[model samples]
Target: MKAVGFHEHGPLDNYDLLDVPTPEVGDGEVLVDVKASALNYMDLFAVRELDNYVPQYPFWGGGDVAGVVTECGDDVTAWAEGDRVVAVPFLSCGDCRFCVRGQEMLCEDFTMMGEMRRGGHAEYVAMPEENLIPIPDDADFVTAAAVPVAGGTAWRALVPRAKVQSTEDVLIVGATGGVGTYAVQICKNVLNVDTLYATTSSQEKAEFLRDLGADHVIDYTEERFDEAIWKLTDKQGVDVCYNNVGGDTWVQSMRTLRWGGRLVTSGATVGPNPETEIRQIFMRQLDIVGSSGANSYELAELYDYVWSGDVEPVIDDTFPIEEYMTAFERMDNRGLYGKIVLTQE
Candidate 1:
């Protein structure tokens, strides 16, 4: 099987395209003939071995996969050959307390598929049967592959973790990035929020964010985004703020939240260190919620939304599987509006 992998943690150029032996299905697993895979920012982070979450050498990096099942193991009865599916990226121990409660993302043994183990950046991948979700016959592999990680994470952050409601005002920081693009669409179309504010460093992205359903787009390069939000909201802050960009924008996100408002975060792209305003938390009774990947139930909900056209994944570009390095370079430069997909040929 041909796959893209890295023997050492470093730059994107360190990735190598080589032929390795195909993976085998275990008793409770299924072998998938990967049609397409999507890249997440975590893929870049994993390549660099940042934040102590290091993968062993020869690590394959990709998280979102959509493909057809080629073979099923003895214990895998729910699916069979030729079944089209998308795998949920969150891998968890079924016996864990969090997993038992349908919160698999919070399980003590929780890990991402591409980050902790061999992922779908290959011709074939063997995954546990439990992680596979059926994809509609009408959906293409590229669209299906775009759903698992970015869409799932957005669903978890805005819908469940933050509980964004129809009439509430929401602010999505970094609204043009992979997760941010999904968040913008889902918040507007799925949740039907009253007002949506999106912040971006680029004017070109500000226009794109508006097309993605952001009611107000602020160019963070021109002015302080918090002040813009305050002005737009008439001195009142947003009901909720999505803080995916941690260090670079966390303080501004904190300032943009109304009293008693919630700030939900999933990733720390700018580095996690943020000045803590202890008084703001206590005096305003604000809620700061940290979220990870979505659970099975949330992923299922996200799938339904995608199928129904309530939310759609934006693809900046698609590359052949062997061009993994080029894909990573595009991602590292922030040169995309949404998820970058790699297709198996």
Candidate 2:
């Protein structure tokens, strides 16, 4: 099988196709013919910073995948061959206390596909039956692939982590990436947020955010987002701030929140550690909450929205598996407003 992986990774320039043996189907697992996969910032880290993360050579890294089952394990009854499915990215040890309670994201042994294990950036990838969810026949593979990671993650950030209220005004710092696009949509379409403010460096993305239901879009390149938010809210600050950009924007994100507002975070795409005034948290009574991978509950609800078209995937571009470097280049340089999908064919 030809996969978009590398024997060894030093940088994105070093990653290319690898002639790897096909993965075998295990009990309760299914072999999927990958149709489409989506790119994320983590892909940049996987190929560059995550040294020795894979157990072997020829590792293909991808977390968001949509495909069709070509073969199913003998014990698998819930799914069969030719079933259209989307991979739920995260794998958890089912016996853990968190997993038993359905909070698998908190599992002690939680790992993400393509980051800690073999991912679906290949022609064929094997997934556990439980981690695969059926998609309707009419659902586009590229769009479905874009949904699993971004949609569920954005839902986790806004819905559960931030506990966003429908009547509260919210802000999404860095609203142009894969998760940010979905976060804006989920805030409006799913959560019915009263008002939405999102930050982006480009005016193109700022307009995109507005069209996607953000009440206000802040172009942070021209002015600081914290100042913009302060002015926009008349110094009242927003009720919630969905901040994944970390370090560079952490203090500003905290400053944009209202007194008693919540700041929910998942990733620090920018530098992870940044200095901040500790007084802000104590003085304003802010809630700084951190969340990780999306569990089954969030994934299921997010997929339902995807199936219904209430929350749609924002596909900026699609590249063949062979051209993943180009797709990733667009993501790494912040040249995309939404997911850039990779076609396995």
The lDDT of each candidate is: 0.88, 0.87
Instruction: Please state every model's RMSD to the true fold in angstroms.
Output: 1.3, 1.2
- Which is the leading candidate under lDDT? 1
Encode model 1's per-residue lDDT on 54-154: one tens digit a residue.
44657786789999999999888999899999988889898988778877787898788888877889899998998999999998999999988888888
TM-score of each: 0.97, 0.97
Question: Residue 197 lDDT in model 2?
Answer: 94
- Could you give candidate 2's per-residue lDDT for residues 183-229 as a string of tens digits? 99999999999889999988877878899999999898899999999
Residue pairs in steric clash, candidate 2? none
How many clashing residue pairs are found in candidate 1? 0
